[model samples]
Target: MTILTASAPRDEMSGAPDVRVVAVPAGHPYVQRVTDAAGIALLPDPPVPGAAEGVWWPPVALDPDWIRANGDRADVLHVHFGTESFAAGHLTACVEAAHAAGWVVVFTVHDLTHPQLVDQRPYAAQLDELVPCADALITLTTGAAAEVRERWGREAVVLPHPAILREGASPTVVALSEDLRVGMHLKDLRPGTDGPESARTLVAAVERLREQGRHAVAEIRMHRSVRDEIARDEVRAAVAGHPYAVLVEQGRLPDAALNAALGGLDVCVLPYRYGSHSGWLELCWDLGVPVAAPDVGHFSDQHDDASTASFHPGDVDTLTEALHALLSRHEAARPGSIARAEIIEARRAHRREQDAATATAHAALYRRLRSERAS
Candidate 1:
């Protein structure tokens, strides 16, 4: 119940000044959640012209002209997402335009590797221009901060990712029976998500567990692009004969349906071949779902070792063993016990507090950076 406040730091050159920030892609959930808590005013991103009605194509945040025109509206330019669509040269010019208008740049390193990009060079090039130019740099993990120092030689301010789940929203607890449900969500199968191979591996693992009398089910959820395509024919083929294993072909789920789907599962598996940190992992954490994630990135770092099972992607044997371990461990935990339910609720409460603290830490950092700029 703490109310945090941040007063605009006075500008040294201009005396009393207005401190408003233009967050690139200001509508993002993560951006909105933190900024709402940080107590800073934000200038909304203008709608992209000549594009899809709902989508911001060639985002105004990426346009140098937009930055120049709105320079007076914001004292700082905080660039988050919506830059991936921009070319490296264009991104650099966008940053330059902010500077030219005397606006300080605060770049949060949300992704070391852009989630959708298979190619790393372009994103790397964009980082090269933005990282050094920023007056302050922010990142979500200590591991990422170290990587930033080693790669770009910049000491970034480390902050935890704010929680995605709403407060007081408890995860629907499924009565633990012999039947176990594990899920691999492949919404659009982003560049890093190797859905087809991971789905096959999970299905095989579920069958193996069932053969041993563990009684588990593996579910593969995919969008139409992946399900209808012949490239993913293996996924269909893998689940064909299995009654327990199911291949669900559905369009992108709305938030309510997605939340309900996630809450119903006993364990959620992330099947990324390569990537940086994940907000999906955070969501899993918030919902109190045990995560079986690849060893590729910092996904495992978000939770204690006991809560998360790690396996190397493409290593089918290891992945299968990991899945077995998850089922075995859960099966051993006496389900339907009040103690177990209390433990689960306690974890959820802890996550909510962690999220609030993260927001407060970010607000304090912003105030400090602004003070440093003023001095």
Candidate 2:
């Protein structure tokens, strides 16, 4: 059945098909792939910067003219992280415009904000307002979907984030070099007053690993967009005594460079104080790297039942122990690594299945909307 998809206009995809998709001003890692897989044509939006930086605001305003022009062509409007961008008034107007144009609106809620910021009055209210407008909602994880349903009385479809599968790898054993190298990606060292407090703890844990001589070399790649001089100073101060701790400011590396960096690391560690979910963890799982994270919130859910390790967020001892165990297991070629690799592969497979299902489900939704309008 043919369906309409409205999104920002872009030429990345070739000929137009039955589905009409309005490509938003910004694109995420999986945006283009999902659109292509679903056979949707792109409707280009104005140039918007910081699309991937977690700052959801689109540079181009979603005005009546743009919506009228594009909305009329599509049966459905698919948007990502709507709560982050649309204010109550603007969101209400946009929803009304889509409805007026006889279109169904689908929104994907990535984060309600790390648990710490749940109390932020404005963000919470905005989300509450936006939830009810969506004909359907999509979340990255079941845990997140459940939270949205419970909090806002909105049923959301749970689809795991798309996995990053490396070519020519079958979840095989990746030999750990004599030099143990650890990699971490931290968007911000200081998460506002409401942000997670795990940064200090993470730094200390790394210091402990250095002391034990387990992690002789480690690179903590902090994204430049989120890192400030003040945060850098704080990081330096926290790991002052540890000579092995190296802080690399990776402003923004292209996809290939980012993958290359991740491929070289022996292990990937995420020490989150508190959060809803992590796409980074999904990236680690896809890459077949043994992941070490603190026992907090939805993190445990990401770990394969058979192949995952956890540590207390602020407990240096637990963190140290977890690192030691992972390092030792890698050095000895223990079956744990192999098992974990299998879990990673399984997770990736699961994501592919889920993405396909989500696409079909959304397509069905669009078809239903078109039928209703015709009747």
Candidate 3:
């Protein structure tokens, strides 16, 4: 926790700058990736009981008492996730304590509706407390920021998610199978998943593609821990031993392993039935794999026309048509095809620029807020 270099007043004593941001749940990949970005050095969290090695969990920054006790360690408390961990009342108190500590509270509305919760009430309650209480707000896309303003009457800085994978010299060639490989990884059937419906839609899309003389296979992956859950069974039964569909059950993967798994596929179908934005989408873009996500969220707003395709989770026609379009677009860039390689490379270049821009924007925001708070 804490990004710290001294403030301007103290800069006379210290030469460099660091904002000292104590973000909520500092251990998530997205958070780690963002904080690891340009001019922001990573700091190891102080050990906590029950925390895994090199990982920070059950963030103490959420506690009002923690801020009161250690607020001097940070200049900003940037919250992107972990709304589900505390009650709205408690978060409000934490905001008050942060202000009392003279630290700016910057909140990023990462989720308008939390994916793990069946009930939206609690998520909304926490957002109500945070959106209005924080000194500054941030969100991933314009669609999300619009929702935040429409609901809370507050404007949030729109920050594009930085590329999860390192910027490469050139994007890997768009990988394609002789037949399209459509993958749906349902990790533990989070509440946002219409698991069974997603399975049904995939099966139908594959069938339609085959009937149209296009060869395609759908792979549905699930974790062994959720293998016996009702939704798990429902998802498995939805495919019903279809020939072109394969269900693979396995344990969780490390970051590098997950990237390899995703890159192996031609297209990844996001299983979430609802949510705000996706880090998975960004990951697919990084690997030169196209993504197909449910139309429910701001997923469409997160990518350009060719990088992502959207479809309803249950409606077979929409998914089938979306798949057709994605496949055609992919064929143009698939390995050995020179037709669209330059276009794809240009997109990757844009992603690299986006990463730098994102880092600069966050850096500028932090500095401006810090200067104002000091003044």
Q: How close is every model to the real structure, measured as TM-score? A: 0.87, 0.75, 0.88
Comparison by lDDT, 2 against 3, better one: 3
**lDDT, residue 92, candidate 1:** 78
Instruction: State the lDDT of candidate 2 residue by residue for 156-193, as single tens digits.
Output: 87655565554344433446555677666665553522
Model 1 lDDT at residue 121: 89
Model 3: lowest-lDDT 10 consecutive positions: 1-10
Model 1 segments more than 4 A misplaced: 1-18, 52-54, 168-175, 328-344
Residue range 1-375, candidate 3, lDDT tens digits: 112233233442363446677877676666665665444433445456786786555566678898888877877777877668776599889889988988888887878888888999988888888899899988888898889989989988888887776555343344445867888898878788778888888999999999998889998988888733999888879876799999987889777677667766767898888898888887777767788888887999887568788887788998998888888878766533464456546667887676656666666677778779889
Q: How does residue 118 of candidate 2 score in lDDT? A: 31
Measured over all alpha carbons after superposition, the RMSD of each candidate to the real structure, in angstroms, is 4.1, 6.2, 4.1
Highest lDDT model number? 3
Number of backbone collisions per candidate: 0, 15, 3
Q: Model 2 compared with the native: what TM-score?
A: 0.75
